[model samples]
Target: MTRSVRRTRRILQVTGVSAAALLALSACSSSDSDSSASASASGKLSGDVTVFAAASLKESFTTLGKEFEKQHPGTKVTFSFGGSDSLAASITGGAPADVFASASPKTMKIVTDAKDNATEPATFVRNQLEIATLPGNPDKVASLKDLTNSDLKVVLCDRTVPCGAAAQKALDASKLKLTPVSYEEDVKSALNKVVLKEADAAVVYKTDVKAAGEKVEGVEFPESADAVNDYPITLLKESKNPETAKAFMALVQSAEGQKVLNESGFLNP
Candidate 1:
């Protein structure tokens, strides 16, 4: 048979009896369902599940998104990754998304306070800050204080971003005031500066450094302990695909999901 003929047959099959069965199964997991939330764990998932997430979660969330699609063949996982604060703003401004995974509770509050979440946010994982330096540690930087040197061109996430907030908390705890050459909008942007050799170092999440691999070197600082960020996930109130969104959220908080995140260098919540 020709390719178009095969494609038409596939479309017809999807809209047949199988589609009705899926819709029936999906109702069991819908936010309005009287069924327990756990029903979503085993129910059929379909349609598009759009997620707005923190930039720090890009790698791990992408891994989970692929797995979500694998688990439910007809479902698609689309993501909008950026600074947590900016993402929250978009959601509250009526951007359509099924789920929201924020890098910090403070940013999540923006959505929750606006009553934009269908469910209470849950802390799924935590992340800590690390100094991302150019490969070979060209500056021989040893601690967070090392970045304070006026000679080093350092980058940091903007203060409104989660990673930036955590870095500031760490700095305050250490009583150090390090000025960065630039403040990028998100953690990835900050790390990109170091990776592209635009800056000597940047303060970013440990996961980001691990994701960068050979592109940048990670330096651990004791103050990071004082600034660990809690990552939260929630189902959006405006989600058009509640069943699939709940299933995706369940997968994110599942054991298998935790394994993917842990492997990416995120700490347990």
Candidate 2:
């Protein structure tokens, strides 16, 4: 073969190789860009968000969870709703969670004190005590003093829970003490005692009574003014998705969030 012809053939071969390399590089860049765009557009917040809330907030918070899921689309919210103290204990014990919403500042302090919180918690709501009785309030219990009636059976929250602690404070403020047949672990349990007709009355949060919705009659006692509980919310330090957690909390503080809480009878904190 002629030298010029051989040189032309070599040039063609090099040109083909260069074209192939450029095409491969372009394809890889396009694929990477497409993947990143998909991830961002969907915000594909893919992970579990664990929430620890007070028992009294169970119903309302569950509703809020549904709304949150509807808004986030792909995120999952797992809730551990129970006594505020119990929830706090779990969070402090290294349980995995993204958020902590407590019924009492004291319980929230437990998490903050242990340095389990990622940020300063904000008080989102407040609740006051109420006298919850059977649907008809058959005992005709009217005032805090009425609870002293020997014929009336009353249930109270255990001292460890927020509602119980508030009950004690209300009683102390009234300078009245009466023995309760049962000390429940949480407000719902105390409310249950009344719901089941096992007790004549129970000292529970006003929100709880409202949540009960005619299952029990809520009577506002003057003494309850002295014992108010502040609800606090915070993001956890060990959260796997801090950004999404923060966003969820922001939603809770938003107007929509406040609306849900207020509808549940929680006072703005």
Best of the candidates, TM-score: 2
Write model 1 residue lDDT over 16-77, tens digit each, in one string.
Answer: 97889888788756845655655666666779989999999999999999999998999999
The list of candidate 1 runs beyond 4 A from truth reads 1-42
Q: Lowest summed-lDDT stretch of 10 residues in model 2?
A: 42-51
TM-score of each: 0.84, 0.92
| Residue pairs in collision within model 2 | none
Q: What lDDT is reached at residue 249 by model 2? A: 81
Q: What number of clashing residue pairs does each candidate have, in the order they appear?
A: 0, 0
Given candidate 1, what's the lDDT at residue 68? 93
Among the numbered candidates, top lDDT falls to: 1
Write model 2 residue lDDT over 1-269, tens digit each, in one string.
99999999999999999999999999999999999998889765656688888998888788878788888877878888889988888888888889999888898889998953657899988999999999988888898888878888999999999999999999999999878999998899999998888999999999999999889999999999899999999988888988778777887888898899899999988
Give the total clashing residue pairs for model 2.
0
